[model samples]
Structure formats: C-alpha cells, structure tokens
Target: MPARPPERTAADLLTTFGAAPHQTPRQPPTSAKRGRVNRPTAPLRGHARPGHGWSPVLAPLPVYQASTREIGGLFPLLVASPMPAVGARIGYDVQSGGAFYCHPVEWVLRNGLATNPNIAMFGEPGRGKSSTVVAFALRMLNFGVRTLISGDVKGEYTPVVRALGATPIELGAGNHARVNALDLGPLTARWDTWTVRRQRDELSSVLGRWVQLLAALAESQRHPPSVSDEAALAAVLRRLVGASDGYTRLRPITIPDVHRELASPDPQLWRDLRYESRHDFLHQLRPMTDALANLISGALAGMFDAPTTVAIDWDAPVQSMDLSRLRSRGDTAVAVALTCLGAWSSLATGLRDDGDIRIVVRDECWRQLRLGPRAVAAIDAELRLSRLEKIIQILVLHKLSDLYSVGATGSQAVAIAKDLIALCSTRVLFGQSTRVADDLADALALTGPEHQRLTGPVNERRGRALWKTENHPAHLVQTVLSSFEKRLFDTNAQLRPTAGRGGGVGRSRG
Candidate 1:
C-alpha cells in the first residue's frame, strides 16, 4: 500500500487550484442586527426581475375552451387519419398530406365507407374532370375491373379506348356502326334452365326496362305517352319476345320490329292490351306509335333502327361508344342516342359470363336528363340498382344547376334530377365559379369550410377537387397524372395543335 495522502482542506484545495478561499465578514452586534432589515439578493445575471423597470407584468390569458370542431376550423391540418391505402392511388389528401385512394366499389364493399358505389362528379370544362375519370379508369384496369363509357358525346374517351387495344364503336352519319334499342342481349340466354319463378322475374325486369325506354323516347319528342300507351307498349313487347303465352325462351327484337308491329298490330295484341277493338287500340297508342316512327325516320334513322352492327368484346378492358359524330346533329340527337345506348349497354354489360365489377362512366349525363322526366327516371333506376348490378356508375356533369335545368321549378323532372345527387354516395366537386357555389353547397350539404374550399382559389387549380363521401370528412384531392397518362387522357388535342404529338409533360395541375 502507498503512503496515505494528506487530507486536503477547502482552503488547501482552493489555493492548490490557483484560487483564494472565500472569507466571511465580521458579525454585527445583536442590538444593531435587530434594527437592520434584510433585502433580496441582486437579480441573476441576464434575467430581469419582476416589477423592475426592465420587465412589465402581463395580464392573465383568459382560459380558452373550444370544441375540436371549432379548433379544426382554425387548424385544418388536425383532420382524421386518411382512408386506408387501398384501391387506386388517385393522389394526396390536401388536408392530412397522405396519399388518397378512391375506388367506389371497393370503398363500399370492403370498408363500408359508403352506402353505394355510385359517384357523381361536377366540374367546369378544362378543369381536368375527364382526366380524373380517365386516370381512375386506367388505374382500375390493373385491378381487373373494366370500364364502359356508354355514350361519349364529345369523343373524349376514344383515345383511351383505342389505347387500351379496343376499337371504339363509332355511330353517326359517316360511321357504319349501329345499336338496336330493343335488343334483349343475353337476358334470355339461359331462360330454358332457370326456374319458372326466375323466368317470371327476369321477364318482368326485361319488360319493365323496355317500357321505360319506350316511354323515355316518346317523352323526348315532347309527346309523353300516357299510362295506356305504356300498357300497350308492354303488351307489344311481351308478344314480340314470345313471352305473351308463357314461353320459356325469348327472341331479340329491334326498334323497327316494334314500330312495324305497332303500326299493324294483330288482334291478340290489342286483346292482350285489354282494348275492346283494334281501332280503339290504334287511336289510344297513336301518339306512342308516331313517336316511334319519328325515331325510326328522324336523325336517329339507320343508326338505332336496325340490328346492332358492332360486336362488343366483353373480355376487353374498355368499351366506349363514340357519339361525337352525332354531336353535330345537336344535343337532342346525342341525348336520344345516349338514352338508347344506355339501355343497350345495360343489357350488354348484364350479359357478361363472369360477374366481374365494372366502372360505367356516364359523361355529360345532363343531356339525357334534358329529355324528360321519364328519361330522368331511367337514369335514376340505373343509379339505384348499381350495387345490385355490381357496377360503379360515375355520372359527370357541369354543375348542380344542370340538374335543375331538366325542367321548370317544382316540376317532377327537376325533382328527380335533384334526387339524383342524393342517390350517389360519393360526390366529386371540381373547380366552379362562385355563381354555382350556393347550388353546390345546398345540394352537397357542404359545411362552411367546405363551401369556402370549393369557391376559394384552391379549386381553381386544375385537378384539385373536393371528394365528399357519405358522412365522411371531405377529402381535398389533387389528381396526379403520370407522363403517359397525360398523353393518353389529353382532351385538348383540338385546342392545341401540338397536343397529339410529343408535347411538354402534362400535369393536371395546369
């Protein structure tokens, strides 16, 4: 062991470290100390003392108590977590800064995020509404879901369809393709095997659709058929399909065939319609017959009056009807074409062997609404039955006012059109002018912040839309398109001469 080191005192340690030991002052007398008052020590270095000239007292802040709802208005970033990372990666959620995904069908079935898979989109032209739809459709193809544009009035979807390696069915003056409005499609393919009850239900559904289509066509001509006309039409359809006497199998029919039968109906037809005589039947259904004749010979002649000339490949990823050729014929011609094509597409899609999901894009659907209340009813039926059909119906329009324009105020057509908004579980609102804000706010039940978002400059940015699912927090989405998608979905080819050729990288934000 080493020799013990000497214990160091405080003074010895301080002196060894080159410092002097602190010294204490002499104590005062007890009498003197009693008279002297103790004072607070000087303030710490670099700190101001309260009540000193350098520091001023501050009043107490009122205790702030606010609900999360009120606080969210001030800080929009405090939003619920984004939707699960499923479906197509559309873009990013503006509020939460997370990737946004949207697949109406998946959202409904998988997560119960919505009550239905139907979506209604409203946006001004050139706001990337079509682009968003095309992007969604293109992405959905990866999931094995097909897309069907029943009627492309502007021919905007032609490139997309062709890009997907499918020829778009072109119908117009110069085009040779034709679609029969009354084609039963595959509705009766397995009729012989189905039970009698199933047959009855199938026939009733088929006949109901035909009646609705005929009524819509007649209404389009400004001569809405009466209840008797509809009854007569149903009787004629049942007879034409050979279901009048409870036949097991049904045959496909055409508009011309129906027109011919109505023009010269047999006694059984009138009797089945419950009319006393042929003359009474003929007089009572003259308006409907004339409407049919007009449809056969008018602008729609040779297009929808004969058998369908185009063969649709059900396995294809995309199928679109290019009605742009008829766009020159006027909105009425295009609307009439849409109504017929809608019915035909419903049947064609129903004929699929595999009950796979499909996205049915109804662009410019407002034109069909302008036809009449019956036409509106046809669309309403489609929306209501989308879930049952395993289809995601996307109805695109310019604005909510387009629905109001279906008829006069307080009219049945207008009411039906307005109800169309409620039928869709998801509503996508793109950029719109301030003029349409009130209608949008009312139609969508938008909150104050949502209304401001729509009317604000945020929406002015193309591809930026507010996606509102049923009772869910609205998602502000910025639809992002890849370089290839930009070229394929370019709808401004005519507007820009260099659009079709290799051009600058296209972003929907433009």
Candidate 2:
C-alpha cells in the first residue's frame, strides 16, 4: 500500500552518508575530551562495607603490643649484645639474637680473660654434652687444631674420629695396641733435638706420672703405697732410665722393667741398705711386683707391657684412644690404661710445635680423678701447664660433684679435685639434677640466675646451657648444629631415628 520510492542518485547518497563529494569536502562533528568521573563526596552508604573484616566492627581500640626495643628504651641496661663476636660459633645467644662462640683458646687470647686454656663441661647423660664437644672438636679441626681424646669411654667419638679420616687406637687386655708411657715420640718443636736437661725433665715427668698412677692403683686396692715404697720405686726407675741412653733408649720401657729392678736389687745397693730397711723394702716390693705382674704377665697383659704398636699420626685431625674395650677390665685397669694414654698424648704433643694448637679431651675424667690425691695433683699440674704448652684440655664429666666424689668427703683428695676444678677458666654447664646443680653452684660460685638456669627442666634444657669464663658474664646459649653435624656428632643414634637425631641440641625435642 506504501508509495514506491525513487532510485537515489550517487551524489545524493554520498552527501547523505557523510562521504566527501567528488570536488567538495564534508566536515565531522568535533567533541570535547570527556572528563574523569568524580568520586562521590560521601561514600555510598548502605551497611557501610568494611575495607577488611575487622574494619566495620565497633570494638574497643586495638591494644597494640610494645616491642622489646620499646620496653628496653625505658631500661637501657637491658639492651646489649649477649655474646662477643669472636672464635668459633657453638650456639645462639637468643637474648641478643647473636651467634654464640666458645673457642676458649681464641676467646681467652683475644679478650685476655683466661690464664689457662682448659675448658670444663658437665651434664647428665643424654643431655647433649658429648654432641656439643664433638661439634666443637670438628670446628676446631677446621682451624688445623689437633684433638687427642684420651678416653673414649663408650666409643662416642669413634665415629667422629673415623669421619675425620683418623684411626682410633683400641686398647684392651689383648688388643695388641699398646702405648708405652716412656716413649717420648716427638719433642716440642722448640727443641730441635733433645738436650740432656730436657731429656731428664721428660723422664722425671714420666716417672712422676707413673708413680701417681701406681699409687692410685694401690689406693684402689685398699692398701695405699707407703712413702718408703714410692722412694724405692723412684730409685729403681732412675737407675733403669739412667742406664738406658742413646739408641738403647729407643727400646720402649715397660712396667715389667721397673719390677725386675725391684725384685733383684743390685748387690751393692742391697748391702748399702740396713738389714731392717732391706726387709721392709722387699715386703713393700712384693705388692708392687704383684701389681706390676698383673699388668704385664697376668690378666692385663700385652696392652701396656710392650712397645706401642700404633704411632700417633701427627697430621691426623683427631686421634682418639678408644677405651670402650677397657670396660670389662676392672675400674683399676681402666684407670691405669687411661693414665698411660694421656701421658702418651701429652708427650706426643710436646714433640710438636709449642705454637700449634692441640686439644686433649678427657671424657669420663672422674674415673681418672678417683685414683688419689697424687693422681689429682698430676692432672692439676697438666691443667696449669696447658697454657704454656699450647694445649687446650677439654674435660668432660657428668657434673662437678663427680670431682668431689673421687674420694672421702672433705679428704685431701677432695681438696685436690676442687683445685683442679678451679684451674679451668671456662666451664659449660648443661642440664643437671637439682642436687648436682646446687653443688655446682656452690663450687663454681655461680650467680642466682645461673643457678636457676642450670636447674631448668630436663625437656627444655637438653642443648641449652650456661657458659661462664673468667671475668665474663655467664651467657645462656642454645647449641646450634648443622644438619650434617647432627648426623655425625649425635651420640643417641641408637635410640633416635636417622632424621630425628639430625639436630644437635636445640632441635632435639623432649
């Protein structure tokens, strides 16, 4: 029904559709730039949505906690580094968020805080004492420090020694690994060759150590040797040592040689002695000879009665004399063997450079102290000389009480043990029983805080300990071991799963 539209021309279509005509141009409409939409002055108000879940809540103003730094701003003394940055790191000083270091040789030398280079560490079994020592020894080894562990009581250090590519000398009744007390393997580097005086002094020291060991053995037998007996023994020792000189001295002197001299005194020496004196001397010699025979030809033969089959590897990082086998041998036998090993280790170090750092670790040291006052004196002397000899002695024991327990309460032996404890300038105290802690506090003169810390709960304190050094504040340290160290230094591997025992002290859970 609509009327028909006419066909549009090309010009009309181009003009209407906004195309430029053939000769004329068409212009486009100009537009102003659109402005940004302004936000509403007032926020869209419905339920007033919160920026975060807590924002819209009409709660009391949040009570912000003050930081430790803020709190210490009011108490200046409360802010300071808990540990000095020196020596090898052994632990963490949580108080100052710093690494704790305890290399006695370096710390003391740098701080001028100690006169002796010995360190004493005590803890209950499984409290991480052995692990800590092993970690320390490993670190020290990196510094070219040689460690000589005299008594590996449970073979706790055997693995570490082996890990360091060292050979541990296992001593027992018939192990064939003997350590002759008289073999002066190497003299200190100071002496290019042994001078007569040096040789005499070395022999005298060996003789003195032997006398103390023998006296201790006799004391353990309930028949302490008399002064006269010691005098006679000393005479015999001097004669044998004097007769053997030059290349002949190379022959290792054994306990049997001294016994042989006593059994058959030179005719001239016998005639020189009074008749009653001679009789008493022979009587005293009987017990000495019997004890000597037990060591050489009796049950305890072949270990110490001959030359040492194993020589100390001066280049080895660690040399541990494994005494785990000595357990079956009675306490006296073990003590005697340890004494000989210690003597050998000492002399071996003396044969090296005085400036060279050497570590002598005495584990289960209470066993040696039990020998007698004379034995305690010998140890005391060793501790005193450690500084000059460049020997850092690490004495590991159960607790300070072990020292006093060596002899009768309040006896001279007890006094000597106390003296020995005093000589150690640095001490590491791990978790101990309340009774032991109390005793240590008194013996060490620990402050109230230190005493409390030492008596902390067993579960919370395994690897945590209080470290004290001469003229330095005691620091509460948490021993930190690397994952690798944990696997090598752990002593409780038998009880813990492989990965479970990877952390040394702090990582060990209750």
Candidate 3:
C-alpha cells in the first residue's frame, strides 16, 4: 500500500471541489447507533463561487390575510363537509353538490344533529313549499316512516293519500267524516292494565289536552276562556272520563258531551270548581258555554260534534284529513277545523308502539296560532312532546310574519307563536319577497350571505329552499321530484288552462 496515501478525508474532497463544508461537523459513530443512517443536510445558499454548483434563489411564502367569510367562499367544502346522507333523499345540497336527505326523527335520535324532531317550513305562495313537504313525506315512506297530514286545508294531500292506497278522511259541513275533539284515540287503550300512578299521570295528561282544546275552540268564537273557565273544563273532562272517581275503566267522550256537561250545570263539577252554587257556576262560565254551543251549532255543526266516523288505519303508509270543504266557509271556519283536527291527531298519535315513527304535517299552522294564546299553547305542547312520542311535526307557514299575526304586538299569543320558531330545530325557508326575507333573516339570525341567498334570484326557482338544521351552517337545497311526483303534488291544476281541458296536469293519478 505504497505509504498508504494518507487516506483523503471527506472535508478535503469538499475543499478541493471549491464547496464549503457543512457548519456542523459530524461526530464519530458510537456502538449504540452503529447502523443509523444520517439524513442529508440542505444545500448552502449564496452567490456561486468558481467550480461551485449554482444556488437557486429562495423566495418567502406570501402570507394572505382575509376574513373567514372570504376564505369560506374560496374553499367552501374544505370549511365544512356536507350533511350526512342520513335520512330521506329529498333533494341535492346546492353548496356541496351532494344529495340532501332529511328525516327529523333520525337527525335528532340517531345522528344527534338536532335536539328536537320538529320542523317549521316557511315560503311565499307558489314557491313549492307544499311540494317540498309532499316530496319529503312521500320519500320518507320508503324508510318505513308513515305520514299524517293533521289538517289539509286545500285538499292538497288528498292525491298523495290516495296514491298511497288509502282514502283521506274528509271533514266539513256536508262531509260524512267526523273527528271529535275529545276523542281519546289510542292513549287510553291500556288504561285498565296500567298501574295506579301511570293511570293518574295519563288522566292528568288527557284532561290537560281536553281543556286546552276546549279553550282554543272557545277562543275561535271570540270568547277566550277565563282561568275559571279552564278550571271548569278540566273538572268536567275528569268527570266525563271517570277519572275523578278513582274508577278502573275510562269512558270516551265527544265535543258535544263536553258541551252538554257545560250547558247543564253539574252540581259536583261546580263543587269541584269551588263555586257557591249551580246558578253562580252557570253564570260565571256563560261565555265558555255559549262558545261551545256556537261551535256545535254554527259553522262547525256536524263536523266535530259527533263520534269519530272515520277509522284511522294506523298501519297505512299515509293518512290525511281533507278540510277543503270548510275553505268555502271562511278562514275562521277552516282555522277551527284545524284546531279540532290537531287535538284529535295529537291524541291518536301520542301513544304508539316503540319504533313506530310518523311524520305529522300541520298545513297552514298559522291559522291555529291565530286562534289565541291557548291555541298556541296547544300547538306548543304538541311540539314539546314530539321527541317522546317519536313524531316529527312539520308546521307549514306562508311567512314568518304569520306567527306574529297570532296576536296583537307584544301579546301572549304572539310571544308563544314566536317561541314556536325556537322549538323546531329544523327550519326550511323557501323563496321570499324582499320584505319577508329581511324579517326571516333577523328572526332566524341568518348571516348576510344566508339572507342574500333567500331573496336571491336563484331561490326564485321552484323547489329551491334554505334548510337550517339546528345551529349548523344552513344548506341551500333544490328539491328534485320525479315526473310522477310532479303530477302527484301539483296544486296549480285548477289555475292551469290545460287543467280545465282535462290535460295531464288535471288528470288524477298516483
């Protein structure tokens, strides 16, 4: 090895090549790290020297600053993913370009995305509010969730009900169908088998609902009942149901039966109500009695006074109560019919077997609120109980102002009606005029972008709506319906000239 040319070191080679060595010198390897490999160091940056490789210039990264609002627009999907396709596939998410699905119960119970299974839908006329609701109900049918249109004022749901192979129960002056406001429905079916405590609780609930219904009915006639009137009604309901006497069996009562009890002063009821005498009790509750009498004999005559004539097929995919006949009577008449149907439906759907979920649609629900605070209370109770009953109650309104119209400014009814907006965790807002859109934005705490989207020209198209589920970001959705669904949910058949000529629009089909 001819004097072993002093083995050249790595540093000597770097100096000979006119390249500077790394500033940090490598240390001798140790037995503990013998097999470890060293990572290469970054190349030095500077002007190139003779025989040295060129060092590329490095530029500083540009730091962009913008508000989240601006950034969200730039990267919408990155900001938030689309809502899971968990429920009924009603339409498409306009923002994320994904299919949109909604099942209020599933969203609340299974997904934990909502706190309640109630929804409030608002829209201007011809904006497809009704169509969207019908589409949701129809699609949810495939999920084994049934639907009940508590009060269909326009008979709009009739075609859907029939299409589902079930006849809708029609109620009005000339209609044969009857739904007693006091009918207990399925709630009291197992009363005898329940424990005493259960019976007492059930009785209290039954009486409370009856009294609330009676108060609303009385208010419809412009006679909002007094506190004493509610007490008398509760007492009478207890007596009629045999709950006051600790009886094992219960009795089913009708509106007329309640009216009869109120008309003929019951001595025991007067005593229970702490009245001095029958004459005093009769004189004090005169307005309530007169109101009940008017309901039995006036516009609502023969509609809700008799026993329930229509048998509800609980197992059916869908059921609707047609109240279009009363539309000719007046708004007030239709409202009273809605109040009665709401109460009847609440009782019918209250107690059901577990896993039996139903969607209850309250069309023109503002009319029910307009009755007075008591009526609003009745609706409020139903909304509150939705979670426990496994019911998804959908209230349809033409505008948010409809709720404010429930009573005078700052009135109790207005307060309750306004609070109704909070109870519904899901709110679907359709196309609105400039004024209505502004009010909706303020009421819902919608952002500037959300408000713009609501009144935007894009929302003007039919079936376009803004769906706000709880406190999550709102979704712009365009409801998609099949040709069959379009024909099935078309409510403008009467307005179309072709309909008069018996065109496909007017032709009845499932």
Q: Estimate each model's TM-score.
A: 0.82, 0.77, 0.83
Model 3 stretches with alpha carbons more than 4 Å out: 1-80, 109-112, 499-504, 507-510
lDDT of 3 by residue, 1-510 (tens): 467677775445444554444435434544354454442221565335664443342222123444555445545576344466777888887777778889787777665778898999999888888888888888888888889999899888888889878988888766688787788777667776788998888778878888888889899899978888988888888888888777667888887888888889668778878889989888898899999999889888878888778867787788998888788888888888898889888887886664688899998898877777888899999999988888999999989888887778998788889989999999999998889999999999998888889889436579999999867778898999899889888888877776345554773632
Error of 2 at 409 (Å): 2.3
Q: Write the per-residue lDDT of candidate 1 for residues 320-365, one digit (tens) a residue.
A: 8889879878888999999999988987776566888999999999
The stretch of ten residues in a row with the least summed lDDT in candidate 2 is: 55-64
In model 2, pairs of residues that clash are 186-351, 187-351, 188-350
Encode model 2's per-residue lDDT on 1-510: one tens digit a residue. Answer: 998899885445445545434533333223243242242223345235554233232222233234444434434555465345666678787456578876677766665766677988888888887778877887787677878888787777877778777788887745678777655466323334677677666667766766765665555555567786777666666566653344235334667787787777775444544425656657756886666656676445677667768987777888888888878877877777677677677767755754788888898887877766666766777898888888889888888877877678988878888888778988888888899889988888888877887787332856777888866778788888888877766666566455555733322211
Prediction 2 TM-score vs. true:
0.77
The stretch of ten residues in a row with the least summed lDDT in candidate 3 is 54-63
Stretches off by above 4 angstroms in model 1 are: 1-80, 498-510
- Model 2 root-mean-square deviation: 19.3
Candidates 2 and 3: which is better by TM-score?
3
